[model samples]
Target: MTAPVLEIALLQVRPGQTPAFEAAFAQAQSLIAGMPGYVRHDLQRCLEDDHRYALLVWWETLEAHTVGFRGSPQYQEWRALLHHFYDPFPTVEHFVDVTPGRLPPS
Candidate 1:
């Protein structure tokens, strides 16, 4: 298994708040994309469950996110854009992409 290297944040917006959620999320994405060691982030909306959204984030390491990104000025923007959309704090989990196929061909 690879070292635990990815931080996953799963978010669920309040019902009927998708538009507001997206507006904030877009602003955050713009800010976070510019940070060092911030590799990628993608957002998904649920068709079956309208209030559900998924935020998939990849970074060089967990420290790059929790320490570097959150510690930077850019994090304020990230917070402003995303914090209110959540009905509650997000469920955060960390795991490595350890599947033989989950990792890039090497």
Candidate 2:
């Protein structure tokens, strides 16, 4: 079996738009959840920065996200719903488990 990959994105929302952005994300998440190879995901808000958020997504493989999700028509809908909230846009990175079981499931 292929080990899962984690996708991390640091999202910075426009000033005073955190609530709206969160609401939009709540709706947008289902799109990702239904995708092939999707495992799970989380959205976390920074303690010191209300407008900053972190998105962590797990997939069965990197291609599950980079190609399967991003290349699909649903991705365009995902972008339309949530992309505008970012100021400079978020940079996404992928990571592998340094030690298996170090991170617990959510």
Candidate 3:
């Protein structure tokens, strides 16, 4: 079986837009949570930089995000609801766990 992939995005929201961005993200979360092959996700704010956020999403495969989600209509809605809050567009990347075994079960 293929290991899961993690999508990482470092988001720099416009100054003074954190609250709006966070509120929009709350609404947008459901769009991603319901996608096929989605494992889970988290959006964390930076302590040093309140305008910054780290978005981590785990998916069953890379295509589950690059194709399955990005190509779906929900992504358009996701973009519409949250895109404007960004300063410069965020760069998204995917990674697989490199350890001998993944994280221990909780």
Candidate 3: list runs displaced more than 4 Å.
101-106
Residues 73-93, candidate 2: write the lDDT tens digits: 889999999999999899999
Query: How high a TM-score does candidate 2 get?
Result: 0.92
Instruction: Return the lDDT, model 3, position 94.
Output: 95
Which regions of candidate 1 deviate over 4 angstroms? 1-4, 101-106
Instruction: Give the Cα-based TM-score of candidate 1 against the true structure.
Output: 0.84
Whose TM-score is higher: candidate 1's or candidate 2's?
2
lDDT, candidate 3, equals 0.94
Taking the tens digit of each residue's C-alpha lDDT, what string does model 3 give over 2-49? 668999999999998999999999999999999999999999999999
* Candidate No. with top TM-score: 3
Which residue pairs in candidate 2 collide? none
lDDT of 1 by residue, 1-106 (tens): 2243667777889878889888878767878788787777778887888888778877877888889988999988788777877877898776767676465533
Point out the higher-scoring one by lDDT: 1 or 3. 3
